[model samples]
Target: MQKVCWPYFDPDFENLRERIYGPTCRVSIDNESMEDCTVIKVDSVNKQGLLLEMVQVLTDMNLSISKSYISSDGGWNMDVFHVKDEHGNKIRDQRVIDYIQQAIDTTRETLSSSSLSSPKAKAKVYTNSTLLSSDHYNEHTAIEMTGTDRPGLFSEISAALADLHCNIIKVHAWSHNTRLACVAYVSDQRTDTPIEDRSRLATIEDHLTMVLRAQPTTGSQRATPPNQQEVKASDLQGGEGTMTNVERRLHQLMLSVRDFDEPASESSSSPMMPMGLGPDRNGQNPRISIEEWNEKGYSAVNIKCKDRRRLMFDTVCTLTDMQYVIFHASACARAGYAYQEYFIRHIDGSALSTEGEKERVMKCLEAAIERRVCEGFRLELCANNRIGLLSDITRVLRENGLAVVRADVETQGEKAVNAFYLKDISGNEVDMEFVERIKREMGPIMLAVKDETRRQSSSEKPTMPFPSLGGFLKSRIERLSHNFVTIK
Candidate 1:
């Protein structure tokens, strides 16, 4: 059970009172539900990344997801999953089940705390920026954007595209020194054509400009500016609600570079290369090198690897998960390879202080880079969008013993064109026979999703929450003030 602080009586007491009485999330595992698996069911309020968090917890518990059904009605979320222990049997240990429940309960407590007390930042206005035009080839129209980096940046841009009815095809984004640069290839979803309307393009640009300069609606930590401005008292008092677990985790992990105002006591004059790791002379494999700038109080990491979709996202995700706060970073691809450099320190505002720490980090990074370069299978799936489709697909992948190294999931014009880069459980290449087996197993499931979509369209009445600009604006504001999710 989560601890409660019941010391004071004020208007804020309502929040505490509610927490004390909030609906308790029920998590239970039934060992006899399936022939050889356990069924775990969870009933709770939904939030962004909730499914992912569940999957992570299960994975950590040595359980493999075989099947899942996720649905949300009104505001409540009901999720059920069929899973097996590492030995491919039903989980019968009461202690393990209790542990799993506790982990999930902790996730909810963290979510609630963040939503109740997250800070609000003031919004800034930005000048209108010109949208990019296509060249002679005209493959796709691009929207090139550069802005101050902040939490929920991706979600904000996605919301803007959805509002404009622009379909995103592909996106490449990079961040460095508190700035983000993104280029999105997009189309008009309704027309299925390149965005040609000048007014519409202008509106798209305007919306993104507003989003770029806007205060973060999600409770992710605000990116500290160079001056390390303190949060205003009013901002703390008037926090927006409905923060996600991911945002809160990020807020806890990230320490803005500007917070480090002290000079380093020691500095390295030469670049530090990995002692036992190096790229082949033929340049067939990825390479990683780490150098500590002790005087500057951070480490400089350099990576050279094959460029692939979602590579940047994966790299950032790994660093963030490892509790490294990036102070400056840059990446660029050329000649079929990517070169990335990062200056980073520990989350606690300490440098990699010891040889052991440096060595461990270097080894972990090397393994990560190698896993990306390892031989893998790629599968592309396209279908009309359906609720919980991604969750289903991810569960299928896990059930097949395939680890997803990278994935790009985007929906355009109500159609989702997704890509998955996968490898076997041992991080080795999968054979063609295994690939065929995956396709054969997933074929029916994919077909079923499509059939379900058609059936729903034929039998159910459609309703729009916002049918006019007034309602749309109101809904947008409410969403922004609460939990804002990316449209995809």
Candidate 2:
């Protein structure tokens, strides 16, 4: 019998290895790999939430990940992503490539500097504006609200802010499962500065809570009691009060309120479930499955749904916030559908063990994906920013019998660039005549109808089989081995 020699483990050797390779982050972009997309390769020292940081960077740039392979183990991470622009063309712009490189480099530096901190501290550093340039949470007051959603809820909320002498600088709102979550950035209307008066902030919060508590007559039944409605106001000035990304905050708020729970009256005919191209060609809704991988000590999550922009970001963000760590994952978009698989374990290194936990995960993932669905016509408005601009616009929408399913409001310099996904009050398609009349009434607002069909058409191309988990893992291993051989 041959004797087997076991390698000795040394603490000093481990410390030396950390010193040698801990701060290394190498990102290479290959535009010539495949004819359809750009291949991005990243190798770095692994840490919690690193995958999410990278994915957020790419998705924020409006880039689509057509395919990707992720691996993070043994204090190192390596990932390869096949990405394309929104136009379904290979990335040929040098400026965009350089921007991605810079963003990744900045991420690496931030992580390195915060290496000694807790995982939560590192997450805060990455989520701050150090890696992504955002003006939404700067020099403004942020108002967060979660309650039952209704048709004219936003109109009333905006009116309350306007009455409080607060100007809406930007707002992001989402509705799902008969619940609404929104974050509105507002400044003092007269001073154009953050709202600092505690009394006034209290008044604003109280007034909005009343509006949210007001029941809707023609939508899904209100499940939560009026007294339980939540409204929070805080100054988002520089320093310790900085908030995370508005969308992520919205997700957190919704999850905190347990929006994933299916209401008793929820149905396909509910106004909250606006009909459109949300379902795939086969008329299938988002399918999510979670199974235990006992061999690997991880829970495998698989999701299949209609592909859309920022899909990966939404899923990964939800998982990270839920205290799950993704160890290996694969994502691919073929035809009009997205297929994603993730092997994840709790932060405590335990796989999901209960059926109830699996059900909750599935529901949460489904809700996250549905929150960002483009359900109605996208109306974009670009005009000069003014004290009551958002209020005026939303009032027009409400008066015209249109309801905003989703909205993105932003201010660039003196310009208020806002986009709203609009449907009729009954959740039916909006009348084009109404849109035309509103365009004429709102003079100089520069309202235009975006071509939603173009996006749908882009996904209607050729189809391909989604790679199975076994095949994906095999290919990933082969690719990693090839890289190791080249390095040696």
Candidate 3:
């Protein structure tokens, strides 16, 4: 008689196996491999959102990804990135290299561990803590606000905070689709510490809510009612609350307010619309399309737009936040244009099946790409750090009829380094004469203007059209098959 064979089961075997050959990550940086950019190669066990996590790290360090090749097949991921510094030069700083190595290693370890299943663990792993200043994470209070966008809006908000004896230590603000999102870090003016009083926090929230809900002087219609606008002031000094990334928080704020929806008629007339959504001289508005990859059971997303810094971060962040899993992707930027293709599916392993879903995805992607387009002249201010400095500077700007389109404020030890993109309140080019006068009055040594070349109208068309989806997939599959054979 032949006995039936039963499969052996050992509970401890799984854990032991994981210890021996589980999720492992290796990262190497090669400055010699590429002539114009540093090459970073990563090999690791495949998992959802891994690509986005890696991209976020590089972007936080202000590195520009000129080209990247990403693949995740058979439960393993291999990625290669060609990166340059903000000046479009290869990275040569040893300190930066060490930081990147450490950060990526930490990220891998965190992701491989079981703790990542929790929200707090995910937040800790993804927060931009390394790029922050030397101060402790809880040194300042975090303020998040979103409402309708208008000229001089930032000035009014800063003035209100100053009046409440709050000092702005760090701030990042962005305006898109007639909506505004701001994240500001503040401290008490007298004590130079995070504000802890509950009443004071409530007062701060109330004051800012009013400022955001106030009617616009420029006759722009409000997007939402006073009760609908969001204003929150939180003390980050204690507890286990998840610390949010400033840029990611801004993206979330804008999305929560449905900034990707069709812009109001009044918004279409704003200066930002023409530059952000209208066709450029090449007659190319951001082209984003999605099609079904039936054989692969994926949705292929293709995007073509003017290349700029942080483009990868924005798109990846949007996709990840939307609960999509990217199986393969490629990005290449050349000659002032960028082309990106992604093969993705829903987290549940389903492709986008409906027209409404595909359309929403495309609109969200467009908004994400356009949110960071600088709309006006770039202004850099370097001076001694002091209380009420931001308020004073913004007051000056408001008085000069200059509107802040985007702003980044930081404090490094005893110095303050701030940058603001400004446009005339009347939606015209900034007056150089007025800028010069303001510089003279506000200490010419402290403020400097950097002229940005305006986007000129062009009658010429694109030299080549975007590649067809069928051809792109064919090439991608061929490349992947070749890689598989070579690896074996």
- Candidate 2 C-alpha lDDT tens digits along 339-430: 99999999999999999999999989988887777555688766666676677767766765567767888777777787888766655444
Angstrom error at residue 444, model 2 = 7.0
List, residue by residue over 1-488, the lDDT tens digit for candidate 3: 99999899888787655534854777899999889999999888887777877887898788999999989877888899999998989889999998888887777776677465743211110111101111245577777677777777888888888898987878888877667877777788998887767667666776787787777444556545444543332222112122225677778767766778755565554533312222232345689999898998999999999888888988988898889988899999999999999999999989999999999999889888877776557887666666667777676666655678788888777667778887666555544444545445443243566645343335533212112322442343333222111100
**Residue 466 error, candidate 1, Å:** 49
lDDT of 1: 0.51
lDDT of 1 by residue, 15-65 (tens): 654434666477878877579778889877765445445655676565755
Model 1 vs. true fold: TM: 0.29
Global lDDT of model 2: 0.69
**TM-scores vs. true structure, each candidate:** 0.29, 0.77, 0.78
Q: In what order do the candidates fall by lDDT, top score first? A: 3, 2, 1
User: Model 3, residue 227: displacement in angstroms?
Assistant: 7.7
Highest TM-score: which candidate?
A: 3
Error of 3 at 23 (Å): 6.2
- Model 3 TM-score is 0.78
lDDT agreement with native, every candidate: 0.51, 0.69, 0.70
Model 1: residue 338 alpha-carbon error in angstroms: 2.7
Query: 2 or 3: which has the higher TM-score?
Result: 3
